[model samples]
Target: MFRAKPTFVLLLITFIFGLIPWIKAHNSSLSFCNRTCASKHGSGGLTLPYPFGFSDGCEIKLNCSATGKATVGEFPIQFVNGDGIRVNIQRKCNRSLKTVAQLFGPNYAPTANNAILLNNCTEAAFPCEIPSILVQTHFSSVSCSDSNSTISCYSERNKRAFIDLERLKKERKCEYLLSSISAESLNTSEAPVSLAVEVVELGWWLEGQCRCDVNANCRELVSPHGRKAYRCNCTEGFEGDGYKAGSGCRKAFSKCNPAGYISGKCGGTTRIVMLVGGIVVAASLTISLGLIMCCISRRCLKWKMRRLTKRHLSEATGNLNIPIYSFKDVEKATNGFSDKYRLGTGAYGTVYAGKLNCDEWLAIKRIRYRDADSIEQVVNEIKLISTVSHPNLVRLLGCSIDYGEQILVYEFMPNGTLCQHLHRERGDGLSWLIRLTVAAETAQAIAYLHSAIKPPIYHRDIKSSNILLDQNFRSKVADFGLSRLGMVETSHISTAPQGTPGYLDPQYHQNFHLSDKSDVYSFGVVLVEIITGLKAVDFSRPQNEVNLAALATDRIGKGCLDEIIDPLIEPHRDAWTLWSVHRVAELAFRCLAFHRDMRPSMTEVAAELDQTRRSRSWGNSEDNTCTPSSEVCSSSSSSNVSERPLNFHKAELAGRRELLTFGEKSHVNLAQHILRD
Candidate 1:
């Protein structure tokens, strides 16, 4: 051997040392690739790829059943691809979060392309994309029917693919894993086709640092627990596993031959130039075509949706005999929904005073949000109102479901709402007689909903604001957006509590059990408002008196009824006025009972209020000027009332006796004594 220079010898030694590790790595990779891990066919003809096989020597062992179904754990593998695998997890009503926790492994985890829905969660800070009705339909078991329980759907954009299970458990006190939806499957509508099987993408990776081939890319991954691993993907113009130990990357086949170009065969440079130009031209045309197709598809989708909405509206209102106005007409009627024409805004929509083409003044309600929920509410109100024939109920004149708008037209009430009269001074103040009449009429309307129909209907939202007053001060219950049809066989419908804060039934709020009594409870708050002329929920009041119902209940319970009575009615406190006021207060107190069973039915309540109004009429006819302390006012009414037997339940009789005892030491005693006789 020839003697080498000092610099050459030093470089040679350095190169040898670096080459030793590379040689060892190459041999190890060769041995790993040579090791046999036979692949198998799975259900739906899915292939079980290397690194995920049924036998030993595989990175991730799969369980292949006799029927050819492959599973990693509880999740069935739907398909396997070069980059990842798709698994299906069947959703169950009672599938626990702990069960889903087992889905994570050293080789695989759910990718960012999945959105998880947590059912019956205690804290649902995440966005809820799934409709509650759809969830109810899929998970109908009693365990999943807790209306008070919340459902949360979790997803992140431009973040790590893996889900942090520990963070979810700590942050969201979720009880069950409802389902998972693919990110690709979701759309702008936010409505999925099915919830039965949740398809989740699990990105698989090898356990150590990346050992990718020359033509592959290495992607570093950190698990939910912060363990590091790496995945390999073949670079452009290549295919296969991308890992040196696996099949590794190989050049993808193409119509153009590299050898022919290098050898100057197959028509030489002119042919090569034409091929390149043709590819560029084809790609440009393809991109332009794709854009045009996308635009056409979007427009077609919108057209289809509009047509479907019109068809649905026609079918829904076919037998209701209500007209469907055009959106252009409705917009013109409200002067393009001008601020001056706007009557008032409520929780779900804004009402505008619109004059129709027929010279009809109507209240047009334009739902604030054009969403499925708002559309459903419009349909619900139309169906419920049209099914019943009651003078005390608001009349649905027509609706417009055009141009993606949900507009409801109703007969206008010139006098506005009872709440406006009582609290906001929108119109002339209501007298005690007018208030009582409104109360009785509202009761009749609600009673008709609860008892008149075969299946029965629940006016889930009952408040003074929903009680509209006409020209003659007659009350009509409006805004049936939250109403529900009750079943004849069931005692109560299980549903989430929905109503104004102060008017929501405490029992319904706690138990999620809705019944006719729930409406009664809300109406009781309205009763309190009528009696006190105070806002149902007023922050200006003292903390303990914030809720008018609570304050009225406390005062009435202590026999301090006069303290909470409306001052406007005080000047007219004759013997009959006092007695009738106390009686109505007593009725309201019963309606506000904490237990649903203790609350009176709407029918009973309507009858009692009617009788109280009749009693006041009888007293007025006899003598309008009699004072509370007058012998003529006291003796004559007592004798006349005692002669007629009232249809009072035993509970009412007992309640009356208790009231008499509580008021014996105060001025309320005279009213209680009159009520007792």
Candidate 2:
């Protein structure tokens, strides 16, 4: 028998070892490019064509139910069309545009001329949600205005760039909805009726590749409707679609005579021999690799678990004495996250009242998801709570991270959230003095964070819902999930604007830069809530008054502040009560300023409030007489001012602030602040 020459054998071996995998890889890539990964749910009336993958390759898999309600991942969406998807309006609570884009991953983008609708944006000044991937700033936003209840921002670049999801989640401000529509809808006589979507239109392709390898042979295919579809093809000397699944590239003359092998052509026999040998070798190596991998995988997984447990225990729990409770202990404490023990549910998690073996009552927060955002929040709250304590700030006693279940333990606030006192429960409610004191203490606590710490902390969410009261009705600022660290060196920290819709800072929302001033803005809204006893962004009220912040600002501006004050919180018709109320109203007005620079620093706000308290005290003790320094009785001496006095009062207060400035330190500064007790 004539055997093959040594040189020919070497070449064949090299082809088997190296060239086969490449051909297979090229074929696999081509298959990806040639085939359109589109699917449709006929029952649900949902269409998933090119640019919308029904499986892994697509950024978001459009899943639809029988009822025609579409879902991207787990989020309920209204529709998915050629350009984009439309999110269901009712399902978009607490979810922002940035959050929606993130569901699709970084490579996808909202198309230019895409519309974004925000929930609870009635009071938010535009452009509420900036699509950072499309443009870094809102320079050319189309329909944003200072007081529009709803805003539409057309993408500046007509396409989204690859954005860092973690960074965007941290710094995004727009509340995103689930829906998409044709570009023509943008020019309709009116916004789409009945199906107004809060969706981001994602771009069709990624930056460097068209869902294919950079080296894959590619061609842009135009659909019958003139839409461009990118597909991959095979290159010269290669067969198949250049995709591994398509049986990858091979020689064309597969049926050539075996005699060709005598001339080193490897006709059909040599080809078959090479193929069989390659598979046999690969199968043997795969079996060996599988066994090794199984053992190594198990060992690595166990090692990683032990390492993570040690790290979390050593670092997160640390020497702070904060207990790291187990899942069983927490379960026993709350009786299995029962409704009977549940306190309430907020944006991130639910709270339940729990009692320790030591008989001390505490609140346990069981978060919704184990995503990075939620985990980061838990870590943030722990790191923050472990530090500087204050009477006005809630204490985080301990935490549990068992089996990915995140639980945070805090000293139970018995009286309930400040919101309950302001509106919901409203049993006798809080007095103006109590409300004033709460405001003062909250400010002092924030001031401590802003000035006392080397690098201050900004409590991004400073609403009434976050302020809790103990049995004695003392206020403590609760919920540090949205808190951010401030730098002493930099003027501001660029981050995603996060907070309750009604209380988010407008300027910060417009530009993803956070500062101590943002807290002052939210606190100002809280102040208004305290005085008015109304929701921050209520839509039930007349369109103009839907947003309490805007309503209060409008009323204060027009000199009619008394008309909008909550009847439940009607201040007694006494000089001091009226004076105190007026002063706080003016302070709130200043706090609600659109520009951060215009808002007073938390330190200044605490000092001024302290001065008001002192001034009121000095007046009653000094025989109720008007003194040169105390301007309680201005030229308009009538018991009732003709119109809203906050605006007029603000003008006078701004000029005379030097007189009202208190040189005293805040209570938070004086206390050996303990976040827990």
Candidate 3:
């Protein structure tokens, strides 16, 4: 060996010591990256691989139980094959389209390989890959009663292998998913093995820039939403996830190449040359990384400031000295207006149930129109409703009128609307007493609007659907979009008639004169709906009886009230019940008069209804002494004095007595007659 200088030898030894740890750390990282993911069996004996794991570091995290069962959200994994996973979707008749939309994620989505069946579409023009009869037979769980529904199929053979749910909903107008299946398995000639379980194939990929090992390859692709995406694969003679952060590429063969140190083909000079080249490459990488980090930091700052500026601008534009919420806050509360939170849709807007950041639940109405006229209407509603306050009125909690959105927040009602209880299959039927109470409370709310407020507000649209009910089943008047402030000097405001078809006041419809009496006429329709359990407008009924108000007018005027009364209330046919029902029916007849002047003012209507409810006798025995208030009794007695005859003749008067005496027996006959008709 040659003798070396003491100082040079000392420096060499120190450098060698430093290199030892660096080499060890580099080797350790490579070994860790090369280690494979421990294979595990999930639910339905499905094996979970690299990208799908139970830990946070996984590209697609799945919920795993202690027993090795795995699930993505509420859906269980049926099988895992290559880049696709099949999840078994349970058949449901009323499953929301939002549920299927929720299945999409950053790393995985329903692939274009699936043939999706959409039901209850708004239009019948969508292309159908399978016949509607076949869908009805195989997917028997779904119910699409609309004859115009197209029962469309959506599938595409393309590289963008995931379903764009939002696009599908927007373009097709389909709100319900009947079923989905892999295109490869679909055949018009034969039925699938299982009708109850639909297998949807979802393609998954690692999201973000490729983090492949040195020996792996990266392939770029476009996501369903047109965003850049990528996938990694091990090069020839290697295997594993190919990601540096996952199970990196590993050699498949046991023998090493001739270029490697293990083959004993390299000398000391070669080792020195390799070390110098490695140093230069490492220096270059360090410089490039620092420059990239600087650029990223500047970009991040710009983005943060831009968001802050936009939020500040929104806040400044909002209403001051009021509970003005941010659009982003409202959007987050309603989950970006997801259909799952939607309560109902109307001509003007859709209502969604939202839970705010303050731990308060609210009903948010998102105005559908964005025209200048619609914006003015939104502002008018805010101004008019903010001035009034009542227990029976839907309280406006706040509003958000930013980012081209006009949204109003109100106190949430748990029991939905009066229309739902009276028409749709909601829950146990409303008792006769409850209906009476609802009618009374609703009348009081309308009275408050007509009389209590200065420049009295005329609710031009007062259908049963606009009346919301609270947890206690108390009525609250809602939807002030068509409401207008009356001119105290004038009898009525001149405007185009704008209201629901069946409930619209005929006088107003012809004259274009809007007044408080218009609401009274609408309320009369609601009252008739309460007594008869009939919709305001049903074209399916006999042509002459299409309008419920017209039908009630005919039946009540002809002394045949038994023919139209709801069979549901027939069981409550005590003497008091008979008398009360007749009184309310007579009041409804007066309200539905063709002439607006003939209808009772909301004040008189509220007082009479309140008195009728208070005077009810629970006992089965007849109580001739039980009577309405003096005002209502006087109105009833003096009805013959009015210009328009009260429609009730001697036969109708005698019919009332028969109703009181026959009670349950008469109602039984009426129910049988109704069923026969």
lDDT of each: 0.73, 0.62, 0.70
Off by over 4 Å in 2: 1-310, 316-319, 488-495, 614-617, 625-646, 649-677
Candidate 1 collision pairs:
none
Query: How does each model score on TM-score?
Result: 0.54, 0.57, 0.48
In terms of TM-score, how similar is model 1 to the real structure?
0.54
Taking the tens digit of each residue's C-alpha lDDT, what string does model 1 give over 437-536?
A: 9999999999999998878998888999999999999999999998888873256545445777678787775667778898999999999899889987
Q: What TM-score does candidate 3 get on C-alpha atoms?
A: 0.48
Q: What digit string (tens of lDDT, one per residue) describes model 2 on residues 358-476?
A: 69889999988947889888887888777868888898888877778888999998899889889857567787878888888889999999999877888888889899988888888
Give model 3's clash tally: 0
Model 3 lDDT tens row, 469-520? 8889999999888778898425654543567767878777456677888899
Model 3, position 536: C-alpha lDDT score: 86
Clashing residue pairs found in predicted model 3: none
Query: Lowest summed-lDDT stretch of 10 residues in model 1?
Result: 624-633
